[model samples]
Target: MRNLLNFIIRYGRWFVFAFYITISCLLLVSNNSYQQSIFLTSANLVSNSVYTGASEVTGYFHLKAINESLQASNAILENEVLNLRHQIDEYKTILADSIELPPVAKRFDYVQATVINNSVRHPRNYFSINRGAKDGVKVGMGVVDQNGIVGIVNVTGDRTSRVISILNETQHFSVRLKDTNFIGSLSWRGGDPSIAYMEQVPRHARYQAGDTIVTSGYSTTFPADIPVGVVMNRIHGSDDNFFILKVRLNSDFRALSTVRVIKDEYKSELDSLQSFDFSPTK
Candidate 1:
């Protein structure tokens, strides 16, 4: 107690001066309207800056979760859109059937799936999706994004499927020139994922750079007219009477996340027809 009294006595004058100085400053600012306004504005600005900085730090930590949530929401919305489109197509088919018109070819049925893993720089590129037989995904089903075709499903289990990307050298797809409808086979040279080569197009076929290429719907997997890529370059083959065209793919395999697995209702029928050959020589 005696020590406390001695310390207080020693600093008493300084403490009084500090307290009075604080009071004087407050009183001066309060009495001057402009000074009070300036003080408050400065205080508010500092507080806001501190708060904003803290908020940004917090948001940075939450970005991954936010992105995951956004991806899930996008998947849900895409499924709904696919359902609506299928319904509309069904209605059109019904109307045409009632009128005795020829049956229109079924294009594709969109089934939303998340990419579990993807690769771009590889000779035999493949991607795994978080959907399989349980999710109605099957082998040979076509996969695509809003931009264009990705690949064909090659392996399927109960809960997941692996897709052989169009970038794979072994992968081939039937595609056609958008303007001329001259169909050709699309294949990757195993060097670049961004580019593929279209072959079997006659040399006489007319093409210009930037002409769009799309799926030809000759196969049971992909539908007709789905955008594949744009023509980047064309060169006449030395031995064959066809043009070897380089195409820039629409889908970025490296960045693939969400995709739609197309299920055709008439796939079995189409497969049966494709297997049949009525050649008289045979």
Candidate 2:
């Protein structure tokens, strides 16, 4: 107690000065209109800057959640568009045949997933998503991003799945030229990540440099008409009978973040019918 008293006594004058200076500033600002206005303006400026900085920090943390929500909404819209197309086709069939067919069932389901891991530089490049068998993802299910097709799910775990990326050389998609409806096999040529080639398309397919390529929907793996890419100039390295047209992919594989796993509603039935053994038997 005696030592504390000595320390306070030593600094007492400084403390007294600080207290009077603060009081004088307050009184002077309160009595003078100009000073009061300046003080309020300075305080408001500091508070606004603080609030803005805090808001920016909070918003930055919310991007992932916002992105996931947006992806879910997009999935719903895509499904609705597909159903509308089916209705149009059904109407056309009824008009032509004068026979009422049963309502066309929904053909595809989407499971939104985050791309947990990815790579594009490797030859057999693959990515893993945060969904798997537990989330209704399965082997051979098609995966697509907001832009377009990304890959095919090749392996599935309980809570995660691995996808063979479209950038892989060994991976090929059954895609058709949008205008001519000519189907061809598309695969990455191993050099450029953004470019692939639609191989074995007939030379007389009537495609231009900017024709769109899309899924053929010929198999249960993917639904029809999902945009794959746009045709670049045709390359001269293939056989004379077929044109190998370069395609610039729509989905940016290098920046993959969110994707959807596609489920064919009647995949099991189709697979069973296609797999039945029809060889000669005794």
Best by lDDT: 2
| Tens-digit per-residue lDDT, 1-282, candidate 2 | 989899889999998999999998987556422222322321233433453455445435546755775687589899999999999889888887666669989889999987766678877677767676878987889998877899998767666666788988778899999956799999997867899999989878887888899999998888999989999898875489987889999887776766899999999999999999899998
Error of 1 at 165 (Å): 0.4
Q: What is the lDDT of residue 6 in candidate 1?
A: 98
The segments of candidate 1 whose C-alpha lies over 4 angstroms from its true place after superposition are: 1-107, 277-282
Worst 10 residues of 2 by lDDT: 34-43
Off by over 4 Å in 2: 1-102, 279-282
Worst 10 residues of 1 by lDDT: 34-43
Per-model TM against the reference: 0.62, 0.65
Q: How many angstroms is residue 47 displaced in model 2 relative to the true structure, after the best TM-score fit?
A: 45
